[model samples]
Target: MPRLMAFDYGTKRIGIAVTDPLQIIATGLETVHPKDVIDYVKKYLLAEPVERFVVGEPKQMDGTESQSAQHVRGFVTLLKKNFPAIPVDMADERFTSKMASAAMLAGGLKKSDRKNKALVDTVSAVIILQTYMETRKF
Candidate 1:
């Protein structure tokens, strides 16, 4: 069975996560630079078959598009063009960062470790993936 992949996208870094073949749990895969994201995913696809893609969609408190949404949308467009066969969907990513932080703290990471943005991004991607699986708001 093909796994499901999720991304927590940023201008600088793109956090990636994937589920097992059973799609039971999401695991942080890697945090890659934006310039290398597509190629990185392609490389990963060579090893693992991914059936679906989930992206964390940024939104404002009032349910409007956040400034980051435009950038994410651009990435999404490129993603769809590159892999039209796989379906892509978005989940509301309002408090994922905060949740990631809390998760890191609860997970007993050191202060310096918790400050790592890459780890935070990866955790956020995991959170996004979990949210997608639970609610599937798309």
Candidate 2:
């Protein structure tokens, strides 16, 4: 089976995560500049067969679309246009950042390391991928 990839899109950086071939485990891949997303995905596709892309959809507490949603939407459009074979989906990302921070704390990361926004973004991508995997039929 092909793998699934997740992206945590941010203004400055994007965190990436990927599932195993069996789609059982979601692991953090890397944090790359937002501008490099297309190139990164293309390179990844050359290296591994991925079937789907899960992007974190940021929403307000009341479930309204957040400003960042527009940016993600554009990214989704780009994905569809550039890689029509790979489907793109969205998952609610309400508190994934907070959860990532807590995870870092629990993992014994230093305060300085925990402050790294890129690290939190990467962990958030992993959380997003895991959430998608749990809710998926397969």
Candidate 3:
């Protein structure tokens, strides 16, 4: 069975997450540099079967597109071009970072550990994936 992948895109770093083959649980995967994301995805795809890409879509509180939206759109275009067979979708990413931070704190992470942006990114991706999954009937 194939899995669904999610990405929390940033200017400098990208957070990644993927569901199990059963598509029931989402797990934090990795964080890659912006320039290395495509290569990272390619390498990951070689090992795992990914059926779809769910990218975090940044939006303002007013429901307007955020500045980072353009970058995500560009990345989506690149993903479509590079992996035409796989479908790409966007999940609203409002407040995921904040939610991730709270999760880390609730999980008893230390200040130093919570300060790791990469970890936060990964958790954010997982949150995005989980949120997206909730909307699907399956």
In candidate 1, position 37 carries an lDDT of 93
> Top model by lDDT, which number?
3
lDDT of 1 at 55: 97
* Residue 26 miss distance in model 2 (angstroms): 0.5
Which residue pairs show collisions in model 2?
none
Instruction: Give the alpha carbon lDDT tens digit for every residue of 1-138 in model 3.
Output: 899999999998999999999999999999999899999999999999999999999999999999989999999999999999999989999999999999999999999999999999999999999999999665
Ranking by lDDT: 3, 2, 1
lDDT of 3 at 124: 100
Off by over 4 Å in 3: none
Candidate 1: 10-residue stretch with minimal lDDT: 129-138
> How far is 47's C-alpha from truth in model 2 (Å)?
1.0
User: Which residues of candidate 1, in runs, are more than 4 Å off?
Assistant: none
Estimate, for each residue in 1-138, the C-alpha lDDT of model 1 and write its tens digit: 899999999999999999989888999999999999999999999999999999999999999999999999999998999999999999888999999999999999999999999999999999999888988644
lDDT comparison, 1 vs 3, better candidate: 3
Model 2 gets an lDDT of 0.95
